[model samples]
Target: MTSSDLCATLDESDALRLLRGGQFQLEGRLVDASNTTLRARLTLDGVTARCVYKPVRGERPLWDFPDGTLAGREVSAYLVSQATGWGLVPPTVLRDGPLGPGACQLWIDEPDDAEALVGFVPSDQLPPRWFPVAGARDEDGTAYALAHADDPRLAALAVLDAVINNADRKGGHVLRGPDDRVYGVDHGVSFHVEEKLRTVLWGWAGRPLPAEAVEVLRRLAGAVAGPLGAELAEHLTTAEIAELAGRVDRLVEQGRFPLPPQDWPAMPWPPI
Candidate 1:
């Protein structure tokens, strides 16, 4: 659907309301609407937030070269976020259109005024051997400080990605929430083949998955047939749901201490 059509689908009332007057208050620019994702920000009320507004464009891309449809990606992101709520993703606030972007979302506030590191790396710098990317990390040296290890949080995030088939878990996408609550973002490029995981956090590789992490996945499994299951069905096909459910079961069978798959890449390159 076109951008305007999305607004009607969400039922957001027309007539824009003014909040502030400056750039933060004015229309937000398109942040990262790429082959897999689209984002925009605008000041609706008094608060300023960012939104990665993705819509279902109906039907998946037939070509293997990889072109993502907005709607499917969005629905998958929302369902996974809702199903795996442990601060692993941003919530799909609302589905409206004709605002700043074609879609309206619960704007994700930046790390509570803690801006990203001096230089947060992007995902493109991943190992050229894994894929072909030259001159990726052109600017080197302390551009950004990396997240510390021993932060039990990244372990949980790794588990989440494994279950969701999220190939793109860039380091920068993982957020340090209030009270050391770690969160993961940008799941639009998830649940596809190519084992797309490109995260930079693997300090705990081969580590036994924690009990709490397993429980979370198990809980998600239980909900798949009920709340979570129903929620996902709207966006994905029945077969996809089955696959997701099956994956969760595999994690549960590991009994909270499954070792990281050795075959998996050590970490996402460029270390984003």
Candidate 2:
């Protein structure tokens, strides 16, 4: 099936069940990752799809997050994205794979006309509707700006990062879909109980959220203590779930894009 057709036919629950029960064949290693990740084909009940698999044993431990929890955090990010009704995250689930228990996320294929993956562009050469994230002067004295395509979908992704406390949202993780929608991926470093948000979407800093985004935030604020909260509790610490609720409340109240933190670089290292 085409990517859009699969997306249209499979709902989140259907995708999750497939990830948990489908036969997965390891296709290759995604060698660019900091930790181990595999590309695989998942087939079940006459449906076939591609997924990225990250096993717990392959996870590199971080000082801030507990060991072997990155996969669960990825699943949690999917849940938050779905609960917000934006469906910003591609379908994801936690399951046992060839390597071990891991995260299986739907793979997004990029189109030919997609925005350049190399995010560093000279300030004067940005495409229409793109916005500069930050600028720097190269050692050779050339000026370039880190930028992202400006779209309402990206704006929604920024809000999603805020609520999930995503600590790493680099340019390459933002997939430009064939449908012209943007999907955020690689959310393993997220939902910490602390203020550890890091992203390149700071272009929206301090701007009032659109009414629709704010409304989603408001709905999330109330839902967190209900089913959403229950689902997240299965993967996150109780304190982390509480913090997520607090973040939702604060974002709904502020109704504006958050600025970068003073103590940490706003963007992740290797911005793309």
- Compose the digit string of candidate 2's lDDT tens values, residues 15-86: 777788889989999999998999998898888888999999999989999998999999999999999898
Give the number of the best model, judged by lDDT.
Answer: 2
Query: TM-score for every candidate vs. truth?
Result: 0.63, 0.94
What lDDT does the true structure give each of the candidates?
0.51, 0.88
The lowest-lDDT stretch of 10 consecutive residues in candidate 1 is 14-23
- Writing each residue's lDDT as its tens digit, candidate 1 over 147-171 gives 4344566666777777767656665
Q: Pick the candidate with the highest TM-score.
A: 2
Q: Least lDDT summed over 10 consecutive residues: which range in candidate 2?
A: 1-10
Q: Given candidate 1, what's the lDDT at residue 235?
A: 55
